[model samples]
Target: MVQERLARRRYGSEVGQWSGWASWSACSRSCGGGVRTQTRLCLEKVAKDNGTDSGDQPPSRAETGRRRLRPIQCVGSDKRFHMCNEEDCPPEAGDFRAEQCASFNEKPYKDRLYRWRPHYSTKRPCSLTCGPENASFYVTLRRRVIDGTRCSPDGGTDRADHVCAAGHCKHIGCDGVVGSPRVRDACGVCGGDNSTCHLVSGIFTEPHLREGYQLVLQIPAGACSIRIEEVVPTRNYLALRAGNKEFIVNGAWNIDNSGQYQGAGATFMYRRQTDTQGETLAATGPITEPVDIFLLYRQMNRGIKYEYVIKRNASLSSVLPRLPNDLQSLPPAPPPALPALPQLPARPSVVPRPTGHRNAVPAPGVARPPHTAPRLPATPAGAGQRRGGVLA
Candidate 1:
């Protein structure tokens, strides 16, 4: 009983303790989600160096009662921040870039009155392109985008959309005409009757064209469609679009992949047959007008020899124009001119109230003379009677 009592008493006086965290702080923001915090000041308990009992001494003091401030071991970083400010904005108020561009000036840029272009990002090409009247080395170009106009990318003048790219044109044959110097299709070719044409098939390689890539082949009026095959190399691809329908021809296999596909014209299907080169595809029964052919290739002036031919008496006519897509999808107009500054309902002019001040000060040069009393009749020395202020 003595041993049990001593053991129970030894452990009775002390226990470890810690405090719970305080309540969380209010949310940082109202509309959008934000951050809050809850934290606790960690208090540490340690045995005193003086070997004093904590039960007898206060938590801060040891046996001597001197305050011992122990460096904190549990100093914690608990503060945090997060996203906020999600109030709904007006529909048209969000696009700051457009507003910046649309900002106006009464006078801007070289003293021009109404600048059609934007104050920034105005470097875009404007003009049509054409080929030389004759095959001279000369090339003419319209002026570049205005100087100091920001390039589209804003870094520098590279691959800029609004600025003029070096315009290119396909080589019009010696006989074929581009835009100017209109002459008859000399060989009476594409639009010509079959009298001048035969089953001519060979590598017809022409080096140049005018302005952009367009090749007009004269198919007879009755023939609806035709097929072109690649002879030498493989994987020469071309796309043909009529009305809204489009088809691709992998000329390597000489497949008229387009002739079988749905077109705006009548459907025609043909199979491939070896014709010493690769394969042959024939387009039948869709021709209503002369077929316009365009070859799709890059590094245009690199002068790669392309081996292909139009078989059915195709003649070199004029090259049609390849127009570029609009550079910027501009707003229909300039946001209605910012609503005309609201015409501010003019008010009648107001009469200003006079400042409170006395008017007693006489104007300069005016003066008041002293008033003299009416002459009083002399009165007898002792009588002292007065009527109208005369001395009695």
Candidate 2:
């Protein structure tokens, strides 16, 4: 590879030829697989001017316009990416995309300032699109990301093996060669035989007893080329949890749509094939941490098949330690606590009412007023007899 790079550097340097490649730019990240880039120029002239060799000094922009020569396009790519700083970043260092978004934090946009966050989009893989935290809309902050950034670090991209080169997604291979055909085998070795690692696979057939989520299996740290798939579709879901017991996908009974999730120091591609009612989880990894696999058993489980590559000397027991009997089942959720009933003050007992008014008695603390009878009006003698003829 070094020799090929050196040869390309020398290819077009004879006067009026392509210029040697410029020094590579700084890496896009300090760690965690960032990119660096270098560029070359096409110096071949487009037109014969001043009766001199057209190659002798490529025409200046003004001269090219005057000559009206067809615009010269280079025969090959002028820019290329170099994968660099592949060492993993410390856990506390945070994410690279977030760092890019933070570059615009507190900066004015449309006369306003917002706490920006990285907005992922596979369509514009190399563009820096960001939005205010918790916002539904995003703004394309830059036409392209800094060269060397992964084309789509979070995955779900058609060009998973590409990176940004001069604002464009360009192919890169496991061998670090642009447009190289080399690919990693199932063992996750760039060019080694599949024999380098041992494949561990099993079909989990544990009956899901009264389910929400049930422990199915665990993939240990340092696992690579991990794949988990439902053997039969039952509208069931595959759930993943990190070593810390933090849910990675389909946790809390909330069904997540198909997408990439970050956990265990790797990106997991979780897909729900609605057409087939199938669910799958995959990752290309030597995962930095162990991950637990679970099944959301909405119905009777058919089976879940899982496979991953581990070091040749590693045993299945060591890589996938069995959970204790108590943990084999989903941890029971504490039932919602019932609120306490408020206490009421006691009421004084009421004395029985006297059976009759004769039994009623007045206490010494009260004095009763004397009772009086209602008065009646006197009637007139003539008014007592009927004045009508029938009454008389």
Candidate 3:
């Protein structure tokens, strides 16, 4: 029997392992669903037993007893097993639990994207429109409250109105008004304590549409000429000429609030006239000398309002004569003899009146009057003897 069993084993080896192949094919055909299900169940059982899933690295024997298993998907071209998709994975795999997705998750790279353009709205409607040709421009003038009380035109106390036409044109939405040029104040022109000159303050001229105009400010007393150092305008160029000299002032007009121009401080120079040139037909005429005058000018809407103050040198007193005779010598005086002095009689010597009171009377030793008088009984008979004898 031993000899027969040895011979049978030798025969099976020589049959090309047919039994192994047959067993594999039979298992595949007979247990297709059962084997796959069994294999998945066995993997899960092994993960639970070892504390690891097919997607995760196998836990150490010591940790396997305390850990749990997680699921994972196949990755990489080689189809090698890897840890599950969790924080413990290699950094190159990225984190799936982050709020913002990684750059790779977004579509259309930055270089391929386009930017949006901005849009603008049209301007708002204006409340006012263009005014007539003769209308004066109004400006809304505003100044921050600084050190002093509010200004005119409803500035101070909320009721006082100190605004001028020139300053009103620049105000917002003011279309300007049609009116005569009005003078704001006399002190605005004359630099003195007394602004008594009515001419100093008034609308000198009407506002016109002309580009260039001339206005003369008459000189007041106590000044010889007007001194003008500056001319400020809101939107125009100005030129000034006095005698043989001329000057130019550059300025601009603002229309955001009102449509007029106004300036605070400005000056102009003028000279008073010295002599007049009377008509003379002679070939050689008398020399003409220019007089000096002083003037002041203020820039306003439409035109410049002028205020003139004549400047005279205090040293000019030298040219005036000191004595009346010298002044009279220049011209003849009225003829008449000096009025004669009225004759007066000599005054009587003043005599003291005798006092009737005894205390005021002269003393008794001073003098006494004679008591007897001569007799005239024989005057008739004595007339015959008067030729021969002198009366005793």
For candidate 1, the per-residue lDDT at 89 reads: 35
Candidate 2 wrongly placed segments (more than 4 Å) = 1-23, 28-34, 38-80, 85-146, 149-156, 175-182, 272-275, 314-316, 319-328, 334-392
lDDT of each: 0.30, 0.65, 0.22
Order the candidate numbers by lDDT, best to worst: 2, 1, 3
lDDT of 2: 0.65
TM-score, per-candidate, Cα-based: 0.20, 0.52, 0.15
Model 1 TM-score (2 dp): 0.20
Model 3 residue runs over 4 Å out of place are 1-199, 213-233, 248-303, 310-392
Please report how far candidate 3 places residue 98 from its true position, in Å.
Answer: 76
Q: How many clashes (backbone N, Cα, C below 3 Å) per candidate?
A: 19, 1, 56
lDDT-superior candidate, 1 or 2: 2
Residue-level error in angstroms, candidate 1, position 387: 99
Clashes of 3: 56
- On the 0 to 100 scale, the lDDT of residue 18 in model 2 is 56
lDDT of 2 by residue, 1-392 (tens): 45434534554322233578999889877887777778898674445432245676766889657534543334456777678887878989876777888999868999988988888777887799888977789999988877656666543366677777667777778888655667777766787778777766656644334556777666778789899887555556788999887899988777788888888988899997454446899998878888888877655555566778876542324444233231555676632322222332332333355442212122234232221111112323453322211122
Say which prediction, candidate 2 or candidate 3, comes out ahead on lDDT: 2
lDDT of 3 at 126: 12
Q: Quick one: best lDDT, which candidate? A: 2
